[model samples]
Target chain A: MNLTILIVMAVLTGVLGSPYVTDTDVTPGSDSAGMSAHPNSVPEAADGTEVFHEEGVVEEEGVEEDVMATGELNPSHYPAQRAANVVKHYLNTRYGSPYRWVGLHKVHSANAEEVAESGRKYHLEISVQEMTGNTTEKCSAEVLFPALENQRSPQVQASCEALLTANTTAQEEALYQQYRRNHTLLSGHNLPDSYGHIDPDMKPLWHLGGVASSFVMLKESTENTLYNMAQVANVTQLETENDQLRFNYHVLLHDMVSQEIIHWKLLVTWSPAEGVKVLQMEELPKCEHCEVPPKPN
Target chain B: MKALLILIVLMNLDKNKCFAFLSFSDQVLSITAKTQEQVELLKNVSTQYETVLWQPVSPEYIKEEEPVHLSPSAFAQSFASRFCFRVLLDNTNEMIELQTRNDSTDPRSSSSYYERYHSLEDIYYWINRTTQEHPEMVKVVLIGSSYEKRPLYALKISVGEKQDKKAIWIDCGIHAREWISPAFCMWFSLSYYNQNQDITHILNHMDVYVLPVMNPDGYKYTWTTNRMWRKNRSYSTDSSCVGVDLNRNFDANWCTEGASDKPCSEIYCGAFPESEPESEAVANFLRSHKDSVQLYLTIHSYSQMLLFPYSCTLDEAENHNELLVMAQEAAQKIRRYYRNTYKYGAGGKTIYLAPGGSDDWAYNLGIKYSFTFELQDRGRYGFLLPPSHISKACNEALIAVKTIALRVIEKTQAPQ
Candidate 1:
């Protein structure tokens, strides 16, 4: 009876051990003993957070460790360094092609001391150089990356989505300023002419149309004497809603022939699809009869 | 393990492929970036999104609202509004197709010098044929080979005895996509060959050297691969980007203000002055014949402006008054004949500061009569000016060239 039991136990052990050996043989690089056969099949926690490994590599056993270590110290302690790394990697991945000349000149942490205790955000200033023939031209960019506390790694994998440069702010300001200025100038605002201030190509339409009907009629009656002077003023209000920049401006228009000044309120909207345009230009009723003031000079 | 291996292979494949999907059907936009901020925005967008800048002006000179051509994608369309640029060309591809169709038609269609934009092969054939047909008037000279080993041909049009005659060097298509420029060169050559009363007078006094296509490799590339390639096909050592802007690759103030250092940029000044074979060859020829080459006329397109040095700086050239007067005369002649307006002024002030231009370099080399003719409708069509408009553009350019040549002859005669 003891011999029969020993043989039976050996057979059962062999049957189970044979399958494990075959699985390991079939999948060479996978850590089958640690977890699942599929290396990329990551497991999630109860709260749907990705559990990461200590080394930041997504290993199979990392799922259980991440879930258990949720209450422990956070892995991404240095947010600034992480953000800088993210941007650097992104630049290399995007521009480091055989056909492109963009090279990373320098990558340094910007506003490191400004990092919040929560370690949720970081900023980095990066300078990139493009090698054209024998010359190297340099341009700098500012990157702002936001970190999610529950992310698998300290570096946001999608920080490229938040890549910001000097252009971002400049682009936004230009749209707002142009809309406001166009609104002011078109609504009969005679703004001062300084170099680079007014559009050189701006031409006033002589045809009677829309809100300019009255102005056109008046201009035709005093065609020779009445010279219409239009100028754009500072944008009083600017907002971006639904991917469009809306602007409000105080416009001034002077009629030299009539010796009258017109104060107008204008609204302008700009978008990539529609381009910079005046949504509405209304001649404010209050300033219709305002007399032109003489210059101090 | 298999999945990991497959992913690595896919990544490698992605690296080899062009990130920007530039196709023949893609739309090109001409937008004005007016402010310093707008210029920066455009430059940033160009680098990040890989948009090909068609304008010859570098990113630094984009201040005060310079018109730029951008081949837009979904990515570029997103930033158009934020930059506050007005759209100049809504569908550049449409016009390109129209121009291409016009160019592909047989050269035998019309007999007035040139009817349409011709290919490099056709232009060469025409050059050879012109030399053969009018052996007494025209002779083809091979100056140098391009980066791709394409021969650079210059037609010597001398009707009178070659002894002691001053020469005028006229080169066009420095920027490859300026099809009108090369067209103008061919037209000027043929028109001068016909020996009209004024042309005969000018030719008798001076020998005209016409190089229709300056950058042959870039011109061929524009015809075959990309229609908007602007630089010579010289590889950059420090960067992977190809080609050098031959106009900006001259030794004078090279790679300075208004010239780019980015290899992929349109206005990329080469690694060194005369780094490109095309520019180097032209430079060598000009230097060798600097004494006899009395006038240097480099033709460019789109902007209706006649410019003279000094383009590298705001400082006026020694012969500023003479140059200004001659350019004004040329512009006035063009206006009188063609009913078109051509702005005539110093290069740096009239158009933004563009260093290393051939005209500027030649002027610095003592060729006081160097003038750059920016031909045709300011921005109505940009580089994609239709073949139908070629006749009108070439006609206007001919008047200007004739005017400048006549002035050079008169000046030389006055001194004699």
Candidate 2:
């Protein structure tokens, strides 16, 4: 369990984002110029409205031409496109998506002949479209697992129950292992204070039966969170005609570990596909001729 | 003269050896008093020293610089009436509210205020409001948190049912200095749901995940202190340097080439493969969703390129032909907009081999449709792409991404 937690934290940190530590003397509105720096001022945009600053443009105009001419040489002359609209969309959406590698030289070299002949450069973009070929039956949450979101429709709940009933043999060990790894349940390191501190060493010594799922709520006012338990009262299963599998999780107001009034709630529904390995460590391959030479690069 | 005589005596005593010493700020003396043989020998020694001093420092110290002009968006903001374009289709008002925070421009010799653009609070407010307005298709998720505890978010674009849908992942803002990456990522999300309404078909079939900024810490740092930070702020106890090139922190081939081990280097690979938690988080998420995530698009900037996998080595991937074709098609679409050209091909074969790249890693992990896009005007605008071009770059990229997404879906749906 501990190893799983450590692995989960490691993976979570990698997937979610890296930690940022900052110390700065500059205050957002500390400048003596105040809000009057711009002649035209307006209230901040209402939700969904794009907010644009005036001075940033003026500054951009002054340097755009110069940058276009010499930016290649200097590289510092580019502009920053602040698209609040796009960011807003992301903050409202979930599931998204680095790294550098070499093999660039060989690829470029191989394509050089083709590129020269065509006098054209290449690019790759992905466009996903819904398929009309096949269909899958909807599943209900109550039928599939131990619990369901409070607000889910009866029909949807029924579908999930059906999914759970069909897959009774699907043990909860994999799911628990995955969750533990994702959360670093056994890692000795304490959870970051940002997520509401949890002692890595704290052991919850109890048998959680029937209840096949869990939700963690961090207390805002105090250093306490709420953990709710429920037994699977009823369930139904819906088997999909297609080979693909999917599932969803739910979080309710009562799931809050704290009673304080918070601005919002985060509900995550995770569905791990069958036969998928939660965590696998693979050995990195080496180049047969890749020798560690004394090339001072 | 006495010292010279003594030196000569010492030299004679040690007959086989010879040496000449010169000191003080500047002194020019003739060796005419010495024998021709001695003079010639001293001249040779002096020439050797001159050659050594003239040798250029190795590893060619070429410093990188950002585009000098304010980006087009900044231009529009300055002259709102003249250059301003509607950033969002939902924005009916002509006026734009300006945040009066100097966090965008405060340059303290000591501290960096990387919190430029809108603050996190402002960003969240904007997202919340946007979702409230358009709750039908736009679902938001705080995918992860940055080093500073700022939430990393993704906007999911889906129409009808989200179950069993193919997923495409687009992450921007990996190199914090490349501010445009996040912008493009954001812009694409808005455009998909707003301007391009037919995208519902695309969304219905696939859930598109867009992460605007991956390296929030380094990105904030870029705004505040160093304008060119290209890594995540990960502290190494062994060194004072506090960052790792997130791009080089993936596990594809796990740091073999086109990366640096030096902590101070811009492209420094972390202590180990997947050393940075942020990269790990992203990798783990993608791995978990590998079945559905058919297309992995990691957006980057300055160089308009559409790259694919096997970045760690020169070997061609199993789907090399398909990836190359897709890349070529996308590059051509980008060229139609402007004279700007973009290169596309396999990662290793097109450019330098870079190990531990996310795209390559994803490709290796069964997500064959993985791509890394380097967007915009060759190097003209570089990281400081103008706002005006943002639409062009984003539009071109959007077209390309949609094009590839469509292609991949068609291929997937085709007779197996």
Candidate 3:
């Protein structure tokens, strides 16, 4: 066989092995390519200084070395930890939940297998890696979960009603937490650009943008416990002179009680003079004419 | 007063004559023919608003054959006779008696008779009775309350069970007008109690929860004013429109596709995911029990279909194989039992992409098995599934559910 064909065949052969095989378990000694033992996995030495391979695939001699190794945090670390905690708390609070795979199909059948595979992928993505990375960094805080803290307040209900009617909020943004957690289990689906930035690993980290939507405040003001959804659009991320990344995103906000809908598209870029700034809001022109309707006489 | 008098006269007139004759009441004599014609121009309106009814014109007027229409006792007898085993109608007879008509234009409303389901009370009564009789396997819980403060209840059924067990949830009536959706849940519950021993074993090992009438206010309104409302009656102060499509109100790819922001639209997704009280209650409940909720089935109507999750987008899910196999098996069982053809595939792939749906939301939350069932004939009957087909449809659905349940028990048991 030709070299190209031979290489392709070899790669396929390597991939087709048992799925349960782990990276470290499969690749040993000189064969290790991209495997990196997590910091927690490494044993602590007598001194604070620790020796490690720059390439994550290998573990070399450990000696007390003085080098600032400031690695960027795993994008999924914060959200995943929070999610795990939240889920655990959820289970504890509710006692227990009923489980179902695919309610309509029988097991060991074609559809059942597909469902099983989807579940497997779900674990790999959410439980293991961040599937949806930061799609947009224009927002200051990502909206993690949306909940009405004052569940019985009339004003909150009225505001929700207003938002619902105006069509300002999209349902997707409103239920970001539920959808984000569930998206991993869904068949292969991709996240929108506004939520997070795509890392080298292709996983979307949670941009502060998603966390902005679910803010709850004891009192309504410029700032409080719950931040307003519109504030995220005003946020801008910094950039260096050589490599400047621009962010364009779609933001959806909905108030259930008032039936108000608010949708805005934002573009933000970095500039040496201004540091970071918003370029445009796509929905401004469209919404200019959509003034709030007059209340009944 | 004058309009009322004329309406009464029209009601008294022979049905055929009323259609043929356009009466110019002397009181309305001042108006010109153009104006008078405009007054009588309107023919039929949806189940919500009031409208004038026209007499049948030959073939058009001929009423189609009604499906199975059994009185409460007769329904019981029919179930016993048809199954040739035990019929569990007494357990859910109150629900059968609480009937609502699918025909909104009919002057004779189903609510006037003993058939239409009037309120959440009626639905709960039936669920409670069904579970009570089958205490060995069934248990009930009041999950939460609706926007209008109606209690939302879910029935858990298993043959050999205790409360602490893995389970599947089947929620119906997201769209209020689809009466058959809730009926299917009732039927499934009853069947688990009365039918096959295998199902009993599966239930004993695994719990099955059913939510009938997710949108109670809209459902109650369907019985009272309108018979075609497809949303929850959550009051929106900004606009006169007062409902949100609960089915389109879930958090799965929520507003991405096949949904509307306008509250008046048929497929209006609420302002946000879990924005409505009904959806929030369900979501909170599910979130709390995320690990145990292995399978989720949201029942809807008209189309005979079995759909999987990720309805918000046209992407394959992680558990596509297992879901596909299970779906096929369920479809096959349904066919064998009732000879009904059910189309099965991924939600986004099989049908148009729909966001903010329960099945998709449940799937996203790591419950690998999520499905939406559009029960009965495609659209000939629409939400108007005849009473005649209830038993057969229920039986078929039960078989399909059992197949899934048994598989779930096996899968949950097999290793991790």
Q: For model 1, state the Cα shift of residue A216 in Å.
A: 30
Q: Number of clashes in model 1? A: 12
Candidate with better lDDT, 2 vs 3 = 3
Weakest lDDT window of 10 consecutive positions for candidate 2 chain B: B87-96
Highest lDDT against the true fold, candidate: 1
Q: After aligning candidate 1 to the native by TM-score, how far in Å is the CA of B190 from where it should be?
A: 1.1
- Per-residue CA lDDT of model 1 for B1-416, tens digit only, reads 33233323322331111122212112334456667777788887766775545553345544445556554434564566554333222223222222223343454333223646778998998899889989998888899989999999999988866586789999999988678899888867766643434666687788889999999888877676545456788887787777787888898888888788888666788888988888888888899889889999999975567888977876888988888788878776655434456667777655456788898898888888898988864432346554545655676677778778888887777654
Q: Higher lDDT: candidate 1 or 3?
A: 1
Q: Per-residue lDDT tens digits of candidate 3, residues A1-297?
A: 132332222122110000111111211222222111211111111111111101111111111111111122121222212222222222111211101000011111100011221210011111111102101111011112322442321111101111112221242233333323443322111121111112222111112233222222111211012111322223332332243334454444322212233455555433222223335545443242343332111
Candidate 2 per-residue C-alpha lDDT over B329-408 given as tens digits, one digit per residue, 9 for 90 to 100: 76665444222356676666544567878898888889989999988644222454434345445656776887788788
**Candidate 3: Cα lDDT at B282:** 93
> Where in model 1 is the C-alpha error above 4 Å?
A1-297, B1-113, B414-416
Off by over 4 Å in 2: A1-297, B1-122, B195-198, B337-339, B414-416
CAPRI-style quality class for the chain A–B interface of candidate 1: incorrect
Write down the worst ten-residue block by lDDT for model 3 chain A. A98-107
| lDDT by residue (tens digit), candidate 1, A46-113 | 11111111111110110111111122211121222223434433443333221122222333323332
